[model samples]
Target: MDLGVKGKTALITGGSKGIGLQTAIVLAEEGANVVVVARGEDALRGAAEKIKKETGADALAVAGDVTSDEDVRRVVNEAIARFGRLDIVVNNAGTSAAAPFGVVELSAWEQDLDLKLFGAIRFSRAALPYLKENGGAIVNVTASFAKTPGAASLPTSVSRAAGMALTKAMSRDLAKYGIRVNTVCIGLIRSDQIEKSWKQTAPEQSWEQFSRDPKHDIPLGRIGETVEAARVIAFLVSDAASYVTGTSVNIDGGKAPAL
Candidate 1:
């Protein structure tokens, strides 16, 4: 499938590693020019280099904090300056900040909201004008916990739930401009953080053995790969999914409880 995104420009937050990096590579493979954003300049540049090397696609690295409005605007502007047009925005920057409600301080809650919910808000708002001009797509990366919150899933759950709402509302409001907004609710996917947990919790076991352990309860038998989620995100942003908007797709390998 062509995906109909060749030559289009995509800006992805959290593109330094894991799912975000994989998504950038996938988009670039499909012939889309990509702008990779993250706080670490070195990581962002490395990701961009990897994308270009793997896909032979144009890739730009922009280092900035997503939680800052000024940084968000600068990222968008730099992308436009480099690519001359923006066709896709993937709000994929976030961390897994969860703790018991009682233990999670007000500061922690504020920081979580700032990084997850408001970060998306800032980038989306900053990219709106460019997206409007081209009739583009925006894919918000959330979590399955947004739909099925578990015990101890604090600010992350709340913030992700708000992200889903933002997707739906943005879809409705942006439809008239030919801009589509959707979200991917991720489950257990291979990532740097997941890798750290694997190393700490089961250092003796191989990654395959550890991930397939019954304790995780992933119905598909193991944790998902970054490419799995990346493919779905790529589809959502491509012309192949032109009619998909105001919807949430769970990329959890059947682990999420909700429909």
Candidate 2:
């Protein structure tokens, strides 16, 4: 089935790698003009090239930090300048800024909130006009910890919880304009961040072993692939999920405890 997104345009932050890059590829596969935003010029260029080569869709790469208002302005402006319109906005720029509860620095807390919470707010505000005009979609990438926090999940868990609230608030407000707002609460997925964790915490373990070690804790017996999360995101942003809004979907392979 055509996702009914052909000729549409999408902008995904942190789109240089992992789930973000995979989402861009999937959207491109559905014939959407894609603009991928990230801080690394090299990675952004490579991601855009890969999308173009694999799907024959136009892909533009914008290198900028989402935490910066000036950079966010440039990202949105450049995307519209090239694509002529914005149909989807994926706020996926974030990392697990985990710190022990008591020792978590004030700066660290501020940083996490700024990047995960305010970044999504800024993107949504900047893209709201265009999305409203086009009756588009906004999908915020959050974490399952937003609903159920675990030990040492500070900053990230708190900020992601706020992100969930933001999604619901945006959905309520934007629905009048026909702009759908939703969120994908992530579980363990293969990504650069996870690789970094493996190297740091389980240096002696092979990548395969480290990857599987956590599976025993999850019902699926394996970490989710980036594309698996990406596919759910693609659907949420497509006409396929036209009736889906003001909701948060867990793409965790039954890892999250809450419904």
Candidate 3:
């Protein structure tokens, strides 16, 4: 089905790789002109080029860090200057800290929050005016741990909770302008971070065995693909979800026991 977002413009943070990249592809596949933002210039260019080649849709890659206000400005500007308008904004740029709660350092907490929290704040602030004009949609990617807390999920869970609060508050404030805001709380997915962990901890095992085994703690019987998460994000951003806002949708494949 057409997402009814074709010919619209979308700005996605952390669009260089992982779920963010997949979301960009999904949006482009539906005919949206997409501007992807991330810090790695090379990866951003590559991802954008690949999306354009595959979907034949307009795609732009803006290299900038989400932690910097200047960088955030550049991303917003690129979206407007290039696409002429912004209809969808996905705050998907964030880092994680997986250490034990007590072992998580103040520095790590600050760094992660700098990107996850301030990134959303700055991106939304800059995009709000333009979004207001278009009656846009905002989907902030958080983590399932915000609802299902775990001992090993430090900083990420706390930061995600804060993001959820932001989503609800923004939805309330922006609803007047037809700017819908929502959150997609993610769970364990096969992404660069998870791949890195598997590489270091259990290089011998296939991802299928490592992520599916009940002993590995996931109930889905397998690890999630980035595309799986992206499909949900794409739907939320679509006009089909016009009635959805101020809500957090969990795409944890039952790994997280939160209702």
Q: Which candidate gets the maximum lDDT versus the true structure?
A: 1
The positional error of residue 94 in candidate 2, measured at the CA in angstroms, is: 0.4
Considering every candidate listed, which one attains the maximal TM-score?
Answer: 1
Distance (Å) between predicted and true CA of 247, model 2?
0.6
Model 1 / residue 80 / CA error / Å = 0.9
Tens digits of lDDT, candidate 1, 125-201:
99999999989999999999899898899989999999999999999999999999999999999988899999999
Question: Any idea what lDDT model 1 has?
Answer: 0.93
Question: What tens-digit string does per-residue lDDT give for candidate 2 at 137-156?
Answer: 99999998789998898989
lDDT of 3: 0.89
Model 3 segments beyond 4 Å from truth? none
Scored by CA lDDT, what does every candidate get? Answer: 0.93, 0.92, 0.89
Model 2 lowest lDDT segment of ten? 214-223
Q: How much does candidate 2 score in TM-score?
A: 0.95
Of models 1 and 2, which has the larger lDDT? 1
- CA displacement after TM-score superposition, residue 224 of candidate 1 (Å): 0.4
Pairwise lDDT winner, candidates 1 and 3: 1
Per-residue accuracy of model 3 over 1-259 as CA lDDT, tens digit each: 8899988999999999999999999999999989999888999989988898889886989998888888888888878888899899999998777778889899989987888988898998999899989799999999988986778888888888899999999999999999999999888788888899888988998987778767657666777899999999999989999999999998877777776
Candidate 3 to truth, TM: 0.95
